[model samples]
Target chain A: MSTFRADLHIHSCLSPCGELSASPRAIARSARERGLHLIALTDHNSARNAPAFAAACRSEGLAAVFGIEITTREEVHALTLFPTVKTALEAGDEAYERLESEPFDPGFFGDQVWVDENEEIEGMLDKLCILCATDLSLDDLGPWCRSRGGILIPAHIDRPAFGVLGQLGFLPEGPFEAVECTEPLSEDLTDPWPVIASSDAHRPEDIGCRCLEFEAPEADFEALVMALESGKTRALYGNK
Target chain B: MTIKELQTDMNCRAVWNGWEDREVTGAYTSDLLSDVMARSEEGQVLITIQAHKNTVAVAVLKDLSGIITASNRPVPDDMIETARDEEIPVFVTDNNQYETGWRLHELGGF
Candidate 1:
């Protein structure tokens, strides 16, 4: 039983499928309410919101891991987490270019908005131009994440779509430091693999409903990541 | 063994000889673009059956050392051309996706 509480797979509004209320502040407040000591914001192929998300979490005295949920060429989903928002954002720049179509125009995604720590709509990202085009590959993005002192984890390996197992039939060794299971392991998963579980929540209400508890030296983001990379954690469920 | 050795062991011809220069970290087999984009690291070999322009795009994005088109399937000419341009090795194997994945695991010690 670890003392630290972590929800490393929460999504922000940047994800097309996530709730509009999935703002950074809302996620931070929800994490606090859920008694989470640490959390990560892994928007789909974008880390644009990670800075604001990290700021919000800091205000609430909660540790945050800057991250993105990248979609690979194999159509597998991977969680790319960073030690800081700057690192996450840099990686996001490369990812945005690869995942997005070319000759980008910000005016295209008029529905996209940027918010501050207070969740106040500040303005549209002028770099909407940046989000418009991409050529990066799945294999390329993993190294970019790792280069920035980040960790890459295959997301929801047990699921059918966008899962490592479902798509590739096996784990491809690359930049991944760990693998995440969205649900409980149906079979005994031990040895030769380090596995963790999270809710992969798209809503604030979903935060910490399922979490990973890491025993670390402190509740800082780096420490927690180190703990996770070291395979020193356990999965906990709220409603189960 | 290195990717070069693995390629030879698998009886695979190197489509991009430069791949011989890169170190083989591990083997990852997948067809899902999103998951691969999220997890693949640099210098690792990618194995899959799906062949398309997006497959090349994903490989470039992930910085994979090379790509193996499994199941005895031939890679599309367009993809091969693209691989040449990107300097990513593209190969076709007689083994199916599963068998190739297992064999690589057994041989590569990944």
Candidate 2:
């Protein structure tokens, strides 16, 4: 088995907060340049860009995990990864349907532009604010993800804002596959679950700033899942 | 005024009644908990739309007198439970943060 570098949480231009230059192709190129063997497209609440990201990653000889950074009812951020693009898009649909139909002001919340694999603008979801929380609670999400052949991890548990520990005060007992922390693993975090770190990158340059290093035969979704399941993943922080 | 008195005056519904009545010396209105942690002083009641348990954690950290979840934001059971544990009263008001802050100012809670 070889140690593979994986960044499982990255936002595409589809995320309103993500920079306009953070397109799927550009993100894939950046990941390749940064020596990322495995990457995931985890735009906030939507995986519409996963198809483009997958194609981009395939062209760049990188493994891609389709994911969504879901904001739950409690306003907690959870990262959900799917084994396939179809499943990711299906999960995305559920999250999209659950979003409140608030009129989105692009100038205020920024644009939600969907782009193709070729980096061409496809369309924009202008009616709903992707940044807002979905009706799904973290409890609801744990089973929701697993049953769909996906995994759910509370994103950035170390951060005090929009994190599971921050929003809920403590991590509720759930079927969490792993927990994502932005910082290096420390004894202060007493959770028994496997811990991994991701850049949660909003721009191309931030794409592999923090990553997961795990022993896997190949840099594929199944191997990554196995690594996480068995608590064999290591968080690489700051040039480590 | 005491938290109970402020609740009554501001037409707020108590989600969690604390162990002891604490005086509301002032009020700070902001949804950003980080801002509250930095700027909100002791004996001040925090007026915000942040209705999660983290807000309660922030209240405890900053030694705030109470938490008023403005705009009638839904208070989760966990948040109330935390407030009860920390002896921090949690109240919900139909008014937004601005209106709640204005009402609190009129009541000399500033």
Candidate 3:
């Protein structure tokens, strides 16, 4: 088989942690220019920008995964990749509803813009997206995402903050067959799930910088999910 | 008024080469990124003393015309890099928060 480059963790401007130039169009263009085969627009706790990002990716001929980097109540982060954009939105609605009631003050944080496929300013959400965490604890978070047909990849497992290893003291036993890290090939893990590395890029240009080269029959969502689920550790190549 | 006019009118300096001809339709002042996200409209100039990398993040999310680091807080290079990468203008002033607020109010003609 052949390996394709994939960075399944990207944040659009929908993420307050992501830069504004991180518009869906800009991200797709940059990813295409950088020779990435596929990417995921995994905003922080919200999939508000995925529809637009998916459309933008379509124009660039890049496969975009509709996903979110969800932070559980315990502060552990998981990258939830959905098989379809609608599924992600459905799960996001439920996740948003579960977030603690914390009103946003536009005078302090700034606006949350939702752009359209044409890069038009569609609307804005007043919620402070990055601060709210889902009510699910670490254990609940995994199954919750899976119930929605999402592939749960614990994000940045090597980091001291927001990482499964650091926050939960250990990676919980779950349906996860693969894991995502900020860097490549971390040997410190007590249990090795086949690792996939991503840039975790909040900025547009950083997309695809720390991606994984994996054997996939095709570059679409199904092929990606199957390849990752198989988690052939020997076939994974990460550019740390 | 354009960001250049806003800077010259308010006596500010370009901290990074983030100057753009984008017009400042209005102004917003805040310390928290979430507050800015929840309230501030697009194309407004954001005023804050919180100088860190995330400042640029808010600027991008909100489509801010520019950022002003009031109270003379030092803007870090990484934050400036984000601004530059995002093409958002960042200006700095030696005045404290109140003085900066008053000047923006005077210029805003409100």
Candidate 4:
């Protein structure tokens, strides 16, 4: 049978938009309920929760991929997925420096809260937890992700925000292995790239509701990346 | 017109007063929660019609300059109260999502 059940993009409470229910344990429990085999907690710019999230996923017999959704200098968005939590953390450090900037008090956004697997409320994050880095460019991000044994996918190419097309009007010369889409597209599109669709879920209800099905030896980050890079995947949206 | 002028011209009320001086760097328009979370930048403003609380969460995670709810849609009371608490700017526009985004892009010079 094809390895079909996985969600490559999800956010924890660490992300400003993530639901309070988006704790690592909460996500894991929800994934289990939804029958997802793999899930990634890719908070915006910060992977501070990855270690804890990964640990929780393991306890639940769910495979977890540590990742961060980084905003490049050009304002394009990319998903950097790592094989190990250590690599994801190290990449977070690099992202912190590259994406870090003075906290903007839009006077409408509240302070970000970090939570553990137990769904317990943790302390507030200082230094603007959301603003992780401003230094990493699209070119630099690719090598960092690769060196750390991670895969980088340009996020939501069809959308008008932070998309490679929306920001730069075209894909950068190199550094991206695939493009993520929120909706389906024709395979013959001229982008000359493979496409992956994810829910990019921020709420538990959203997890595994949409995913990519691929033929692989195993259901792990490495196998998923290889399938995506080789263009051997199909978008699958859960009917439930 | 600059964002400053547009804000005034459109009677755009600044929810977060501190953001007035920051130049309107650019605008990002989206409704899908995950797409916005994965892509938005620190200072860019987000324009969408989705008025759920999760919209605020995504906006905060991305460190968005502000959020504009389009099509003259009313910002939910709970979301407004939350936005007030978070210090993130939230507003409603008479134009639909596409038109509001286009107008913001034209005015912001994007």
lDDT of 4 by residue, A1-240 (tens): 367577888888777667766788888888888877888878888788887798789988987889889977666678889888888878876676555455544333444566665656665444444423355788987887888788888888776656777667667767567778877765553267777777888888888877877778887887887787777887775535
TM-score of 2: 0.72
* Residues A130-190, model 2: lDDT tens digits: 4356789899998899889999999998776688877777778876888888776565563
Which candidate order results from sorting by DockQ in descending order? 4, 1, 3, 2
lDDT of 1 by residue, B1-110 (tens): 56667778878765556644567788778765545655678778888877655577666766787788887766667777777777777878888878887888888787
Docking class of 2: incorrect
Per-prediction tally of clashes: 40, 0, 15, 22
| Chain B TM-score for all candidates, comma-separated | 0.87, 0.94, 0.92, 0.82
Please give, for residues B1-110, the per-residue lDDT of candidate 4 as tens digits.
44456577556555445444344566788765555655777678788877756578667767677788887766667777677766677777777878877777666667
DockQ (Cα-based) per candidate? 0.08, 0.05, 0.05, 0.09
* Model 2 lDDT per residue over B1-110, tens place: 98878978888899865458878888888765545655678899998887888788667756788998888888988888888887888888899889888888888636
Q: For residues B1-110, what per-residue lDDT tens digits would candidate 3 score against the true structure?
A: 77888888999988777465877888888764555655789888888886776678667766789889987888888888878877888888998777877888788663
Q: Write the per-residue lDDT of candidate 3 for residues A109-186, one digit (tens) a residue.
A: 456677999888887765667745667776787778778877888888877556777666777776575787765544
Encode model 1's per-residue lDDT on A8-81: one tens digit a residue: 89877666556778899988998998888988888766788877897898898998888878776666778888
Measured by DockQ, the strongest candidate is 4
RMSD of each: 13.2, 10.7, 9.5, 7.9
Q: Which pairs clash in model 2?
A: none
Worst 10 residues of 3 chain B by lDDT: B30-39
Q: What level of docking quality does candidate 1 show? A: incorrect
